[model samples]
Target: MSLDTTTLLAIVAMALVTYVTRIAGLFVADRLVLTGRAKAAFDAIPPAVLVAVIAPTALTTGWVEAIAAAITAVAAFRLPLLGTVAVGVISVVLLRNVL
Candidate 1:
């Protein structure tokens, strides 16, 4: 019911820690390098990581949704990047509304 000093300090400390960690990325970024194969691997990493995380969630939710999502993902992979994203969003929105 009351805001104690310890609780306020803990919240402040947590915020400061989060801010420091995020800003640390910029400090070290200039020292980091992605060359040749490393750059290619880095490019693929995000999509692969995203699919690994999203695929399981979609599967657990529903097979039909997963199939629909797969169709959208394939379109995203083959088409122009912005066009793919637009088609994917429209497909999912339509699927949700109509199906």
Candidate 2:
């Protein structure tokens, strides 16, 4: 019914954590050396991270949507970055509205 100090503090702390975590990478990147192996790892990281993140979401939704998203992702992978994003957004919006 009333705003409490503990809840307010917790919310502020969470916001700070989110902001720091997101921006921390920029600071960390400036500090790090991108050597041969590090460069390779960094290059490979995007696809690896994408699969890691997408696989679970796609699988959980169901075979149909999952397969659709995968197909869209693959197609997007081949297209220009903006095109890929457009394809993905269009697919999701159509699916959500139609189904």
Residues 1-99, candidate 1: write the lDDT tens digits. Answer: 899999999999999999999899788766879899978987998889988998888778876567677877889768987987787677777787877
lDDT of 2 by residue, 1-99 (tens): 899999999999999999999899889988998989989999999979987998798789876567568768788758987887677777777776677
Q: Ten-residue segment with the worst summed lDDT in candidate 1?
A: 60-69
Error of 2 at 90 (Å): 8.8
Alpha-carbon lDDT, every model: 0.82, 0.82
Give the clashing residue pairs of candidate 2, or none. Answer: none
lDDT of 1: 0.82
Top-TM-score structure, candidate number: 1
